[model samples]
Target: MELLVIVGVFFLLCAVFFIRTVSKKKAVDKAVDVDKDDSYAFEAIGALFTAAERSFYGVLTQSLKDNYVLLGKVRVADIIKPQGNLNRSEWQTAFNQISRKHIDFVICDKDNLSILCAIELNDSSHNKADRAQRDAFLSRALSSANIPFVEFTAKRSYVIRDIQNELHQFLAQQSSQTPSADTKICPCCSSQLVERVSKRGKNQGNTFWGCSAYPKCRYVEES
Candidate 1:
């Protein structure tokens, strides 16, 4: 009877030890997971803009003065959402394309911060196949949005007046296109028509009328 009792106690102790071993393993794993959950360790980037971008920013500050708001590295998705007509899956697909893309610089209305234009500081890389394709996509997207897009080739030195002239030219165009009582309603979306300027290729700097709802309606009338 004593021998049987000893064997039973021995088995009981073995099970207890196995349970303790598993508990220790789980505790250690939990500790490791807690250590991994740390959210810190982020470091500051020395400056917001690269040397080239900084140089241009200076000129923009000078050119825009206090008349407009300038925001850098603005996300395209923030400026325009997928049109309401899109089905959920279609919206998700469209949103995914631009959720991470950014415009190099964005000029916005001072009062409301409405995007007046998006600018790209183009270097020679823009001429390459990949960059060109990406630029084309952005161009198409922004055009569909009816927001003005401007491009300036990167240069070792920039002329402030030149920048002012081009930007003001666009602003002037916008001023001219400002809606009046005579402006017609968009037949597609029922939004009023807005004036727009072409920003690319041979037709660049040309003016046209586009639906105010823009990317959503994409209705156009020749100016």
Candidate 2:
């Protein structure tokens, strides 16, 4: 009887250890899955920002050529999408004196070697008082420096084409006082037929003169 009782106790201890080990393994698996899902979500957001930047550049390029504004000499920076508040802290502090959502773009005027503008694109999720306050601060900063600061909020779902049109109108208004004689040359090929903004890619919003002899004498420079 004593031996039998000892054997039963040993079996009970083994079962308890087995259950605990299984539970721990399941928890680890769950954590890994959550991390993977978060990574995927982040990648998706990055792709969206890239697309928006490209669309904005395309519109600006077309508008400049069609409207004969600034002789297509304006320069736009690449779209800068910060990952989190930490990444955007410095810019936020400069504009709003606080760290919040990331900035979208830092635009410049290559003609006079001055910063022309800064743009922020907000989605439905950004409709909070904090965001408004930040925008107000940015507006004040830009206004004081005689620079243009613009904001665009999605009416419903974010549409790339609509945003592009809005950007074109804003650029036209801003460059109204610019002179046509201020034609910019493409730095790469020294071509005078250069148009502002990059021809392709995520840096599409960047203002640079590209050669009309693209693909052959491809050259570009920030206006």
Candidate 3:
């Protein structure tokens, strides 16, 4: 009888402990339910580009119209990757270097959207030691990837023709480096095909690939 009584008391104590433990857990969970009804607040930005950037963007659009696809604030990691046979840690280290950085503008081939070159609108901010260091690293990285990089000063006014001419030079660079038989070349004079805007023709405003030799070669290809 005594053993039975002790056993019953033990069982009763066990049941109470279990109930108390479950209640305490529930109380703790309820107290810590921070996500229940609270909402995170956010606001939309006024604009993505600053005054200088906006001005430059306008110039780029005017100059590049159907010539190239300009993607702004492109993350560097999206364009280039760590090359060849790296261990996990090395790959991660390389990725981390570029993941946080972005190019102000990336020019892509309009047809296939292949990255062509990267451009930066450097204002006074880029003159700092830190900024200069960042610029050098990015220059090296982009060059290593065979992606040409250019910088234009943040000026109150930019010449449209200058931008067009510089961009044309970079676009022609890939084919000019070491022209393979398959590379696009001016068939007439066997010279590098250069991007040119029609100055006086029915397609005056249109851009096209013409021979760098121009008057002498007179070879033109539709771009």
Candidate 4:
């Protein structure tokens, strides 16, 4: 009986030890997981724009002036979003393409601040294979979004008149299509037709009538 009692106590102690060990191991694993969850801290950097970019900003600003709002370093993801029935993986893949790329310049509406066009300053770096591929991807994405895109080679000297003319023509093309009174109402959202510029694609720089409540109303009519 004593021997049986001793075995029982031994088994009980073993069970208690095993339970404590597993609990301690679980606690350690959780602590390690918490440590793994820690993220890298960031530090402040210097100038956001490179010397080439800074020089171009002056030229772009002077060119745009009060006619349009020129914004620098706008992200592609912000300007273009995935459409259609996208699975999580597909959406993630699309997002990954543009997440890191930024447009050198974005021209927006002076009043409502809607994006009108994007510009890329093609420096020598753009000649590289990786940059070329990136440029092509960005171009396709922008085109798909029906946003107009322009590219200019880096130049030591930029003509203000040339910039002005380019912008003027591009903007003019956007609102060139006028909607008739009968078809002015948007079929999608029942909003009134508003004058808008095509910012990208084959019809880029073409002026077309769009939905007044756009971004919500995507209806478009050719003038």
Best-fitting candidate, scored by lDDT: 1
Question: What lDDT would each prediction earn against the true structure?
Answer: 0.80, 0.50, 0.79, 0.78
lDDT of 1: 0.80
Q: What is the alpha-carbon lDDT of model 4 when measured against the actual structure?
A: 0.78
Report the lDDT of model 2 for residue 138: 60
Ranking by TM-score: 4, 1, 3, 2
Q: What stretches of model 1 exceed 4 Å from their correct place?
A: 1-36, 173-223
Q: What's the TM-score of every candidate structure?
A: 0.65, 0.34, 0.64, 0.67
Q: How many Å off is the CA of 27 in candidate 1?
A: 14
Model 4 regions more than 4 Å off: 1-43, 173-208, 211-216
What lDDT tens digits, residue by residue, belong to model 4 across residues 1-223?
9999999999999999999999999999988997788575768777778888889889988876574778898988888898768999999998897898899999876656667778999999999999999898888888777676888889998998988787664564232234555646777866557566666668777878876544545777897
Q: Across residues 103-130, which tens digit of lDDT does each residue of candidate 2 receive?
A: 4654433333223446666665557888
Determine the C-alpha RMSD for candidate 1 after optimal superposition of all C-alphas.
Answer: 7.9
Model 3 has an lDDT value of 0.79
- Please count the clashing residue pairs in each candidate, in the order shown: 1, 4, 0, 11
